[model samples]
Target: MPKMKTHKGAKGRVKVTARGKVVAYKTGKRHLNYKKSGKTIRLKGKKFVLFKGDARKFRVLLPYDWR
Candidate 1:
């Protein structure tokens, strides 16, 4: 009888693509980057899809995002 609210945190951090896949930025680039390799630095900010299991979980948190 009640509508579900979107998870605010997830809404800010995750994005739903036109095809309905959940995309999120990779972690571990925020600090101590000087010690990391060039390749790691280059790769850190890229977006990636959530695994099927995890995606299923986010689907509920982002109920309206699938459409």
Candidate 2:
């Protein structure tokens, strides 16, 4: 069988944690942030785990990252 290729974009945007959860940075903070609330900006800086449904899809993209 041929080796499966990892989705480069997904690999860069999401990460597999030690416990096997998929974590990713929040979006919507790149531009026009000056108008956003301080709390919103702060919250966007943190990494959040993907929901079970989303994580399952990402797991397929990151075939080699079985962490």
Candidate 3:
């Protein structure tokens, strides 16, 4: 048997919460801010839980994150 490797890219971009929920920052926060509204920029800075389907995918990438 072999251990699974964590996906480095996902490791840097995603976070696993204490409850095992996967979270990630909303996109569109970087670049071209001048064209986006203030509210849009503010919302983009917040972290949001990934949808169930997506979270499952990230879980595989972050196997050791589950406690």
Candidate 4:
């Protein structure tokens, strides 16, 4: 059989946690920060877990990593 291929884009942006959850950096942090609230900015600094529906679809792309 052919080797499993990793999703390069997903590999760059998402991380699998030890418990098999996908984590990604929060969005809206890339631009227009001056209008964003302080709390919003702080929150954007942290990562968030992917929803169950999305995770299932993405898991197929990231076949090798389960976390």
Candidate 5:
């Protein structure tokens, strides 16, 4: 069988923690920061856990991350 390729974009942005959960940075941090409220910007700094329902789908996209 051929080696499965990692979704390059997902690989770059998402991380699998030691416990095997998928985590990714919150969106909306790339532009127009000046107009955003301080709290909104702060929240964007944190990593978010992908929901189980959604993770099931994302898992397929990130086939290289073996459990």
Candidate 6:
């Protein structure tokens, strides 16, 4: 069978952790940072684990187990 192609867009945005969980960075840090507090900006820099339902969807896009 042919291998599935990894989604480039998802590859760049989300990542799989050592525990096989899908984590993605929070948005709203790209623009208008002047109005956002420093803590808010800092928090956005961190990656958050996706919900079970959402993670399952990401898994399909990131076949071959990216870690």
State every prediction's TM-score relative to the real structure: 0.92, 0.94, 0.93, 0.89, 0.85, 0.89
- Candidate 4: the clashing residue pairs are 17-67, 20-67, 21-67
- The candidate with the higher TM-score, 3 or 6, is 3
**Number of clashing residue pairs in every model?**
0, 0, 0, 3, 0, 0
Residues 1-67, model 2: lDDT tens digits:
9999999999999999989999999999899999999999999999999999999999889999976
Relative to the true structure, candidate 5 reaches a TM of 0.85
State how far residue 49 of model 5 sits from its true place (Å): 0.3
| Model 6 residue pairs with clashes | none
Summarize candidate 3's per-residue lDDT along 19-66 as a digit string, tens digits: 888889999888999999999999999999899999988878888988
| 3 versus 6: better lDDT goes to | 3
Candidate 4 local distance difference test against the native? 0.90
Candidate 3 — worst ten consecutive residues by lDDT sum? Answer: 58-67
Instruction: Please give the TM-score that candidate 3 achieves against the real structure.
Output: 0.93
Off by over 4 Å in 1: none
**TM-score: the better of candidates 2 and 6:** 2
| Candidate 6 structure, TM-score to reference | 0.89
lDDT, candidate 1, 1-67, per-residue tens: 8999999999998999999888999999999999999999889889999888888999989999997
Top candidate when judged by TM-score against the true structure = 2
lDDT of 4 by residue, 1-67 (tens): 9988998998898988899988889988999999999999999999999999988877988999983
Runs in model 2 lying further than 4 Å from the true structure: none
Candidate 1 clashes between residue pairs 3 or more apart in a chain or in different chains? none
Model 6: CA > 4 A from native: none
Q: What does candidate 1 score on TM? A: 0.92
lDDT by residue (1-67, candidate 6, tens digit) is 9889999998998888888988899999999999999999999999999899999898888897755
Top lDDT prediction, candidate number: 2
